[model samples]
Target chain A: MVKVVRNVVCPFCGTLCDDLEILVEDNHIVGTRHACRIGNAKFMHFEGAVRYTEPLMRENKKDDFKKVDYETAIEETARLLTEAALPLIYGWSATECHAHMYGVELAELVGAVIDNTASV
Target chain B: MQDVGYPVCTLGEVKNRADVVIYWGSNPMHAHPRHMSRYSVFARGFFRERGREDRTLIVVDPRETDSAKLADIHLQVEPHKDYELISAMRAVLKGFELQTDKVAGVPADLIYEAVEICKNAQFGQLYFAMGVTMTRGKHRNIDNAISLVIDLNAYTKFGLMPMRGHYNVNGFNQVLTWVTGYPFGVDFSRGYPRYNPGETTANDLLQRGETDMMLNIASDPGAHFPQKAVQHMAKIPLVCIDPHETPTTQLANIIIPPAIAGVEVEGTAYRMDGVPIQLRKVIDPPEGVLPDREILKMLIKKVKEML
Candidate 1:
């Protein structure tokens, strides 16, 4: 039997109306109810877009993109972040509170200026 | 409870009690289509049985917008003159004698009429959007509106709400204030939160060639930022953490896939009025994808390892 729970908040915008209901079937979001058009699109977007199966990197002047492992990408990203003198960690408005807090720590450790997209 | 001197009401109350709905520089039809149908003038509330007929809709904008077309009074005030217009309205409300021929394409007569409607309403609510804050005056414009609401209380019941762009943007501001003791776009690089919008804003940092690297969470700047700021982001070492591929992600040197919060992951968020809400996870994120929280934790650990 599918389990249904009400008052699920959709974190897509500032309204944060916690009236959405989720239909879980065998540990899957088979359907969603009581969400707006944007919320519905957000909930079901994964089924349409390519899930970024592999990490990609660009190689030369030709802008050749190559798929790499997740570790390699994360390491490369970390190197870039650490080496940065005035790093600006931007765009955290859509993330959860836990992620935002961790991001704060990362910014403090690297002495980077954390800016959300709202600044624009 | 936080001490808010001003009287505030939920969207539910606005739907029920608001007899005069004034949308200043906001297009709810496009930005918030459901707002009218669910919570404002058009909604069928207990007090408002006739829906549109029960409430007076007023729109004030520089242009004759879609919402303005349906308004009983559409005050097309000049752009960048929001402060002047608001001040003029306040003067009118206080029964100040007219000293000028006209202000911002709005005559003295209209100002008095506007103030009259505001004063006579049983419940008056003002909903403002980016148009009030994105222009040359920015925060000053909002300050005027807030001051107006404060002044309105002397006569009748009045309230104001900022048309927050995203669902959790207010939540973010609230959380930032709670943790860092500042609100919106806080800078913590100096081991403390600094709250200066223009100076500490991301665009200002990038345009000044001060920022070296960037880690974009779910928000997208490339889609909205100016050319100069966009160019800066392009030249910098950019990392993106988002569920979908966006315009900003196209230029990112590193892209981290994060589970969609509220859909694929569970978390807490805040509404427009600083009300906390909980998101329930419904779907599984892609096989290798991680939640933004988990990804940031990993990134923090890696950084610590490097140090």
Candidate 2:
């Protein structure tokens, strides 16, 4: 059986069209209506496409990226930033304001510079 | 975007009151597919009877876009000649006669007809897009358009608005303004908010090869920035934080995928017209995954501990 959800805000684009309906079956969106072509594809057809599901790490550029546990990846990233003389943080178009504020805090602690896609 | 301020109207207000609508360098059918059906021509409003028929539509662009086909008056402009066309229209509005046979490939008579509609309308709206702002004259083109609308106000009610692209560009501008006293390109390295566009803007810094390491938030600059900027970004160590995979991630040394906002997670976002709406989340994120704010908080904790 399919569960119908009405007024699903489109997760795609800036229109924020709040009248779309979605059909969820087995935890996957199988259908959508009242959404534009762009929104429909984003809501209903994202899976089956390639999605990176786990953290990946490469040992200093010579080796291919290997799937690492999230803890290992986060700690490794933190250590790199803590040790680096200069670090920069960029790209934040999808995150919310609270996240950006948190990002600012993190940047301050790491002594890194932060920028977003808007500048580009 | 300019030094001068112009009258602004919402899509709902325009639908309710406007009888004359002008689209400058914008195609809703291609760029904003649902704009017509939701707000402009197709929607039934308080005053708009027979939907699209109640409005006199004008489309001015170098190309005949899908949206132009619906216009009562369509002017196919000469590429990079928007300034001349707009200036000619403003002159005609101010009672000056055009001496040239044609200005910007548009006949003077058509300009007269557009002016006539503007002068006669009860309510008029002129909407512009990136085509005017990103072109040769840039700010000058917008200045002319705003002045044209201001002149129209003497004859009838008029307002001008940019058909802002992206769902939250205007919202971001509003938030940034509220937080930092500036809209974008804010630098805080001195522990103070300092805004300098050419020096601090992402592409400018990248082009100058000044950015050493980049913490890319939710945006994908690699796909959109100019080639020179992208070349420099490719040389730097980069981090990507997004819900989905993009070309930027392909070039990223670190990719931190967060739960999709407005979908897997909920937040407040402002509309194109500066109206705020709270997004409703239907389902939780995949187990072990978290909202972007939470992830950022985790990073903050980790960084502080490192300190």
Candidate 2 global lDDT: 0.74
Model 1: DockQ score: 0.55
Q: How would you encode candidate 2's per-residue C-alpha lDDT over B84-161 as one tens digit per residue?
A: 988888898899999987899998889889889988998988988877876788667888888888888888899887
Off by over 4 Å in 2: A59-63, A69-91, A101-120
TM-scores of all predicted structures: 0.89, 0.89
Per-candidate DockQ versus the true complex?
0.55, 0.48
Evaluate all candidate structures by whole-model CA lDDT and list the values in order. 0.77, 0.74
Q: Candidate 1: where is the Cα deviation over 4 Å?
A: A1-8, A21-36, A46-53, A59-62, B1-8, B45-51, B99-102
Worst 10 residues of 1 chain B by lDDT: B1-10
Q: Write the per-residue lDDT of candidate 1 for residues A1-120, one digit (tens) a residue.
A: 888867777766666767778777766666778767776766654555655655666633137557776677777778888898878887777867777778777877887777665556
Among the numbered candidates, top lDDT falls to 1
Error in Å for residue A90 of model 1: 1.5
lDDT of model 2, residue B104? 94
